[model samples]
Structure formats: structure tokens, C-alpha cells
Target chain A: MATLDIKVLGPGCRNCVTLDKATRAAVAELGLDASIEKVEDYAQIASYNIMSTPGLVIDGTVVSSGRVPSPSEIKDLLLAAQA
Target chain B: MSLVDTLPSSKGKLALVGAGALALWGLAYWVNEWLWDWVMYGVLKLDSANRVVETVHFFVYDFLKIMLLLAGIIFVITFLRSYMSVERTRALLGGKRSGVGNVLAAGLGVITPFCSCSAVPAFIGFVAAGVPVGVTMSFLIASPLVNEIAIGLLLTLFGWQITLLYVVSGLAIAIVAGWVIGKFKPERWVEKFVFETKLHGEAIDPSRGLTIKQRVGIASGEVSTIIRKTWPYLVVGIGLGAIIHGWVPESFFTSVAGKDNLFAVPLVVLLGVPLYSNAAGILPLVESLYGAGLPIGTLLAFMMSVVALSLPELILLKRVLKPQLLGIFVGVTATGIILVGYLFNAIIP
Candidate 1:
């Protein structure tokens, strides 16, 4: 199986925290080797062109912006990315 | 690993810090009294009836008290704000039914520490996240108008009753105005570019693995940044309040905006719309207006108008909303605020 790369974008607020945790949990549940990275710098966040924080990017594609998805939902997204 | 870690982490240290802070706070009042006495009685030798002396005293005392109160309260609130992100709030309000969404958005707006400057970013974020336009409006209206800093300052200046009244009325306006705007289907007024803008790129979430120490550091940084950004406004607001409280003739405003004056509420609202300032900056002026015998309703209306309906905020919204939608938003919010002003004046006093 190929390792997955996940990126979460925010300014370290609680929502970003929650989403980061959920992504980790999903990756673990799927037994996937994923490198999860957090981007907190304002410039970097804006570079994504995302107006909202707490954005999720899986394998370079922006999956969600401005919200935290459930762990199950994250798991589905991760599995789909793997396939 | 470090010499700092060698110090004892004990209850005694905590107690000592607590006692020290309390003592300093208590000393602030004494300092205020001493300064006034020295300046007005000992040095200047001005009698109580001297309006200039009284105004100077008022300015000095209020400046000290309000600055202290603002620093402490802003620190705590900014610290609390660290836990709330706009993205999370958008998520919570997104995809809800209209009325409920408005209420929830308004409620959330009360807790979120957003200022007028953030309106554009929050608006785009909410819309992009699938939150209804009306619900987004509710959050935007309530966020600036019903902020914690404004509420804290109001509570410090006025008693709890007025603060509570402000909060309730502000929320009511936000919810109702948002619902009304929602009914109009104002989404048509949103710029086409907003819907078409696709945010793409690699992103990161720095908060993913923060330790407790990092969180505390972040909170401290936020406190410093907020105070730095807002201190000038605080000083100016309090300075204006002092002038109004001690120097301005009591009859000046009452003659024009007296409680019995039917046009005061709408007039004040009109006066407030073009001015742009944060709640903290405008609140001291509001407090002074109340002191100057402005009706509670008129003052409240004025405060809401200044905080919520400023032209700068409207211009910012223009990035996403068409002119017609912005007009509807302004009209609805203005009407709601005017009605609230009338309602409070009729009932409260």
C-alpha cells in the first residue's frame, strides 16, 4: 500500500485541532502509513486560496474547507484516496 | 533540562501569585484616589465646582480604571478565543434549516470574538462551507455587535441589567434580520466570482499536535497582539467618555435626543452608519451618551449601528455581495435596530 499525505490548514484553533485528530484516527483505523502535516502560517494558509481555516487536503487535492468531518467520513476519504 | 525547571512547582507559588495580583488590583483604586487628590486639591487647588478640574480628574480616573479593565478582560477573552476558530463555527452553522440556523448562528456569534474586520473572511468561509446566506448574516451581525469585549466593557461601565438588555436585544436583531434576509433569497446578490472561486493548494494545520505549553504561549501571544491592535481605540473611547461625563453640558444632548423625542432613535442610527469603529472603541462614547441623558434605546441603537452597520464593513462585504444584497442587509439591520431602540425606550425607562 502507498503512503498517504494529509495536510490540515488553520491557525491552531480548536476546530483545526479536532480535524487533525480525526484525520489521524482515520489513518490509524485504516492501517495506512500517512504523513500528516499542519500548516499554521497565514501566508501558507492563504496560498491555498482557502478563505476559511481548518481546510483538509489529501494527496494534494483539497477535500474540505472550513469544517471538520467525522472520523468515519475521513476514513472513507482516506480509503478512496488509497484506491 | 534547564535551570528554570529546578524551581518548585507548588501550591505556595500559586497562592503568592494570586495574592500579589489581588493586592495590586486593590491598590489601583487607592492610586486613582491619591492621584485625583494630589492634582485637584493639593497642586491645582481647584474646587469641586470647577468643571475643568473635574473633567481632568474624570479623565485620569477613568483612563486608569478602563485601561486596567480592558487589558485584563481582553487577555482573558483572547485566551478563550484561542479555542474557537471561524472554520468550526461555519461548520456548526452550515446546512441547518433557516430559522434554527439563524438562531444558532446568532448564539455562536455572541461567543466568537470576531470584529468588523473579519466580516469578509468569515462570510466567504461560511458561504463556501455551505452555510446559508441568512445564517451567515446573523453571525456577522451578532459577532461584532454582541462581542465579549464590548459586553465586558459595558458591564464594567453600566450595571448588569443594561449589559443583559444589550445582549438580548442584539441577539434578537441578528436573528430576526438574518431570517428576514433569508426569506428574500439574497443569494442572488452574491458575486458570481465567489461561487466560482476554487481554493486549491497544499495546506497545513499547525495546531495538529500542540502541547499544553504551546497553547498557553499562543494565548499569551494573542493577548499581546489584541492589546496592541486595540489600545489606541480604547484610549480614544475612554478619553471621549471622560469629556462627555465631566465637560459636556448635561442639557446639550437631552435638548436634542431626549427620551420624549420621537426622532432620536432613527436620527442616532443615521448618524452611526457612516462611522466605523469597533465595539471597544465606540462603547466608551456610548457610556458617555447614556450619562449625557441619551435614552437607553437611542444609545443602544446608536451602539448597534456603529458596530454593525458601518460603511467599511459594507465595503468589505462588497467583495462577495452585490450592491442590492448589501442594501437589503443594511436596510433590514437598520430597521431592526431602530425598532429595538424604540422598544427599549418605551419599556425600560
Candidate 2:
């Protein structure tokens, strides 16, 4: 099993918070043992080279940025990574 | 006075006025073009043969075109001011029963002439004036969904079929989605701080007598007010779009939003947040995305997301909606956009 590392990179805005919650929900629904991290530091968020914040980084790859993904969508991403 | 009384006297006056204004507008346009030329070719010296500079020039030209459009829009809106006030809209929308009310509200929302980004004041005023949130939502969703400008550009760039699909589907999404949002009754989520400007100007009935000159003057005012407020956002949105146009690897979009990708529509919707644009600014890239074998649904989803879910608008709306409401708005809108994308894909050959 690949250990999937997921980071929700954003400042503590409401959208950021919403993305974080939905991402966690998505991970839990999939029953994946993936680790979820929130990267709130501006310097850390900037490291992703993403212009828009509130991004979702899966396994060091930016899967989505600038918007929140639904839980089911994230579940699919996690499942794809496992495959 | 009636037209019969004023026709002879007003003809020369109106003609003179029209000529003067057009000349003034032409001069302003020329100066603007010259400034842009200098900035691009001379000051920046970016008009070189380099492809990069060519793309940069494309951005500059596109920016100026949008500015000119906005200027023209401003001039027109200055004339429309007396016609499109918040109070007038509410009375027209008041006493809304469901079926036609929703459709009428949605239709009015489109022709009511607001760019979604710049419609904030009217939005607040609508909410404050006791207009149904559903009605306001209909306007909010529809106003930016389709417009004459977007339609004209799409028709010229894409085709009549695409344009027709865009208009029909855009209206459908605004109506259905707005009705759905209304069912949820989101008023509770609005922040306490949102001011509902109590005045809500008295509604004007078109049946009421007004001279053509008065009507023209009002329309002009409406055009100017809306254009002035919205011009900067349009430029910035188009500027970013041009940059996206100039760069953004084609494979990136094709891979992510390819026709066979089931996740394309939803993924594109999720991607639309944080980016802001109008339909006109995005149709060019959308055309290219289609050429890349990406699904129509995916591109449509992306267009909806970018225009409707931009982060800057959210930041601005956060000044009104609470965290939960904003999230719901984003979530619901994304769902609507994705659904519309699939609908188009399935229904359109």
C-alpha cells in the first residue's frame, strides 16, 4: 500500500477550513490510512508554486488548487493513487 | 412633451449631440490605442518578433478591447440608470408565485444587465428590500451566466450551435439552480453586518410617461455606472485569462479534462474556484480546449467555475455570507456547473 500524504495548503480562511474538513471526510470514507496535513504557513503554501491557495496536494502532487473538492472526489483520487 | 411636439426641434439637436459624442468617443479611443501601442512597442519594446512578446502583445490588445467595451458599456449604462434600479426590479419580482415567477425572475436577471462581479451593491439592495432570496439568487446566478457581449463573442468564435447551447443551458442552470438554492432558504447564513439599504428606490413602471430624451439619458447613466464599477474587474480577469492563454500547457487541460474522463466535469468545477473571469474572456480558451479533445462538459464546467466561483468574489462575499453559507454557495454552484456540463455532453450529440 502506498502511503498517501495529503496536504490542504491555504491560509486559515473559511474556504480553507471547508476544504480541510471535506478532505478529511473524503479520506475517512475511503477507509484509507493516508495522513492528512494542513499547510497554513505562507512560506510553505508558496512552496507549492500554486497561484491560488486552498489547494490539495496528494503524494507531493498538486491534484487540485484554488477550490475545495467534494469528499467523493477526493476519495476517488485516493483510490486512484492506491491503484 | 410628446414626440409630435418635439420632433422638429429635437432632430438637429439630437443629431448634433450624437455627432459630438461619437467624435469625443472616437478621440478617446484613438488616444487609448496610441497609449497601448507606445506601452507595448516602444516603452516595453515587447513588440519584437519573439513569440513570448507576441503573446504579451496579444494580452495587451485583448486588455484594451475589454476596456473599450467597458467604456462603451459605461456610456450605455449611464443611459440605463433610471431604468434598472433595485427598487424597480423588486416590484416587478414581487408577489412571486412559483412557476413563471422563477423563470421570469431568471430571465430578467440576465437582461437586467449586471456583470456578476460588479453586481454587489444591487445584490445587497435586493436582499435588503425584501425581495425573495430565491429571486435574488436567480438574478445572481443568471446575470453573469449569459450576456449579449458573451453571446456575440461566442457566436463569432465558436458557432451558432455552441452559442445556442450556451444560452439555453446557461439560462436553465440559473433557473433550476436558483430555485434549488431558494428551496434551501440561505438567509440565515448571511452575516449580521450586511446592510440591506432600506430606501430600495421606488419602482418605476415603463408605462409611466417619459420622453425619449429622458429614457436615453437614464439608459446612458445605467451603462456608465455599471461599466465604471465593473471595468477594472473585467480587465484584470481578461488579463489573467490572456496570461493563461499565453501559457498553460495544452496537455495539462487535455489530460485532466479529456472527453473519456468521467471525473472531468466535477474536477473542472473544483478547479474553477479562486479564478475569476467572464464568459467572453474564457470562450477563446474553451474553444482551444475543445480542439484538444477535452470533453465539452469539462470545458463548460471550467467556464462556469472560473466565472462564478472566483476567490476574489468569495472574499468579497465573505463580507456578507457566513462561512457555512459561503461554503454551501460554492458547493452548490459547483454541483450545478458540473451537472450542466454533463447535461450538455449527453444532450448535445
Candidate 3:
């Protein structure tokens, strides 16, 4: 199976920190082989076309933006991506 | 049937719990002042004439009231606002012209769930999608200036009339300032890369197809996030209010910022421009000043300027906007706030 490539895009605000922490927790819980990267550059972030911070991208497909989804929600999204 | 089995469903159970929580919140808010009075004076035998007791009483009462207000209002507003998103707002403003577009943009800005951190990307996205610069400006201006937290504080502290005036004036400023900026051919002043940068990948619409449970969950999370972030400021602000209420004379500000002073409005706005704090954090001070005999117009102007024209936001916007446009944005918005302040001072008895 291909490794899951996930990206969390934010400029490191509180919400961004929360999202990053939640994502890591979800990854640890699932024990998935995922490479989670933090993207903070404006140009790189703009490329995602998200108008809000703390965007979640799984395998290059933007899944959520503007809010921190819970660790369980992240687990569900990651599980679905794996399947 | 068991009590759990007799319940309609998970959705029904969630609704029941939500309603029960809201009712409890209402009861607590209703009895908050009385409860504090009982504990401070009735039970502890603290004399009302004593400044220390009075200050402590004021702090406890206001802290509970404001916290309750923040939690309840933030939850409901966040829940309702879950239905709106910047993507949808952009779609609405796409292909819109200046006058009408500015109005719509300002109105939508109040409802849209946006954060200042995303202001640059949102600006790029909105402009890239053909939304006019002026309309986008109106949205940006209105988003932070006329937020739910500000509205909640205003309504609770100053009553609905002042709150209504604040909201109306905020929207007016956003619309007019945006229109004025629009007439200046702002496109050229934008950083060259903004126009050149092409957005990649499909924009995800997070606002779409959200279930009630999901919305509730999101709202609860938002409530916690906002409260957690703003609590320190809230404590400092309320503490200042208590100090002012107990230690300072009622006429302390009258000599400086009284209605008789013509410079008070502009001066307050200028002082407020550089300071950055959320409306919730600033309102306690504003309320204290107002109680100390500062005019409503000056206080409102101060609050608006603090929330609307922060140094950090201007610095962030400097990335996308050349110095010239940023200057104009600040100048025009500050002028509008000044005018509103003076007008309200002269008119509101």
C-alpha cells in the first residue's frame, strides 16, 4: 500500500496548532504510515485555494479548511483515504 | 422499553441535551447577580460601602455574566454561521460591481466564518475568482469589526440601542470605505504576484452538507477555542473594569474625554488604531470609561478602531498591498470611525 501523504496548512495560530496536534494524535492512534507535513508559506497555501487557515489535505486532496476537525474525525478521514 | 430505547434517536437525544444545557445557561445568567450579591453581602457579611468588597463583588458578578454570555452567544453564532463560508461568500460576490457589491459584501462579512490569519489567502482567492477589490475590502473590513463577540458584549453591556448603532455604523463604514477605495483603481496597488498567482486544485466547500450533529460539534469546538484564546484578555479587561468602578471617581474621565471636548473622538480613535485586542477584551475598558462619563461616540470609536485597524493586521496586509493602498485603507476607515463618533456624540443624548 502506498504511504499516506497528509499536509496541514496554516500559519501557526492557535487553531493551526490545535489542528496539527489533532492530526498527529489521529495518525498515532491509527498507526498509519503517513507523512504529515506542515505547509505555512503563503504562496504554497494559496495554491490550495483555501480562504481559511488550518486546512487539511490528505494525499493532495483538500479535505477540510477553516475549522479544526476532531481526532476521531481525522481518523475517519484518514481511514477513508487509506481504503 | 428502557429510557434510552424509548428515546427517538441519537439526533433527538442530542437536541434534548442541547435544549437542557441552554435552559440551564439561561437560569444561571438570570440569577448571576443575585447569587453574587447573596454570597458577598448576605452570606459573608461584606459591607457594600467597603471599596474592597465592592470591587471583588463587581469582578465576580461581571466575570460570570460575561463568561456565560460569551459561551452562549459564541456557541449559537458559531452554529448558525456554520452554514456560511468564505467560499460561498466569494461565489455570491463574484461578478459584482462596486456599490451594490460593497453592501452585499459587508453584510455577508458579518455572517461569514473567517479568521484574520487567512486574510491574505482569502484576498488572493477572492480576487483571483474575479471578485472586485472594493467588494473584497468591504468583506474584510466588516469581518473583524462587526463580529459576534463585539455584538454580544455591546448588547450585554450597553443595551440593544447602542449595539444596534454600533452594528449599523460598522457596516456603513465598511461599505463607504470600500467604495471610496474602489474608486482609486486599487488593482495596481496590489502586489504584482497576487494577480499573477493562479490557484491550483479544486476549492473545497466546507460549508456544504453539514449535518446538525456536525454543526453542533463544530460550534462547541469553536466556543471552547474562542473562550480559551480570549480568557486572558477577558480577565485583564474585567479586572480593569472592577478597579475603575471601585477606585476611580465617576467623573474621572469627564475632564479629559467629556462630550465638551471636541478632540476626544479623533484622539481616542488615534490611540485605538495601534492597539490590537478582540472586542470582548476591549469592551470592559470601554464600558468602564463610559461609566466614568465618556461619551458613547468616543468609546465606540475607540472600540471600532482597536478591532478594525490593528497594527498587526496592517503588517499582514502589507504582504499583499503596497504601502500606498494600505495607507488609504487606514485613513478612510479611521475617518469614517471619527465621523461616526462625533455624530453619535452630538446626536445621542
Q: Output the number of the TM-score-best candidate.
A: 3
Q: Candidate 2: where is the Cα deviation over 4 Å?
A: A1-83, B1-82, B115-124, B191-256, B287-295, B347-349
What lDDT would candidate 3 get against the real structure?
A: 0.88
Best model per DockQ: 3
Candidate 3 stretches with Cα past 4 Å from truth are B1-9
- In every candidate, what fraction of the native interface contacts is reproduced? 0.22, 0.00, 0.75
For residues B1-349, write the lDDT of model 2, one tens digit per residue.
1222333237578767767877887777677666766887799777466767766676666666555655565455434433553335556777775456668777876666443433444455556656666667677777677665566656655689877887887787777776776777778877543443333223323323555565554345444544555566656655556666667766876676566678877877877776666665565567555655567766777887887778887775675567877777676767778888988777765
Model 1 C-alpha lDDT per residue in residues B177-242, reported as the tens digit of each score: 999999999889987655554545533233334333333444444455566666787677777777
Write the number of the candidate with greater TM-score, choosing between 1 and 3: 3
Instruction: Indicate which candidate wins on lDDT.
Output: 3
| lDDT score, candidate 2, position B311 | 82
Per-residue lDDT value at B265 in model 3:
89
Q: By summed lDDT, which 10 consecutive residues of candidate 1 chain B come out lowest?
A: B1-10
Clash count, candidate 2:
22
TM-score of each model, in listed order: 0.75, 0.56, 0.95
Q: iRMS of every model, one decimal? A: 9.8, 22.4, 6.6
**Candidate 1, DockQ to 2 decimals?**
0.12
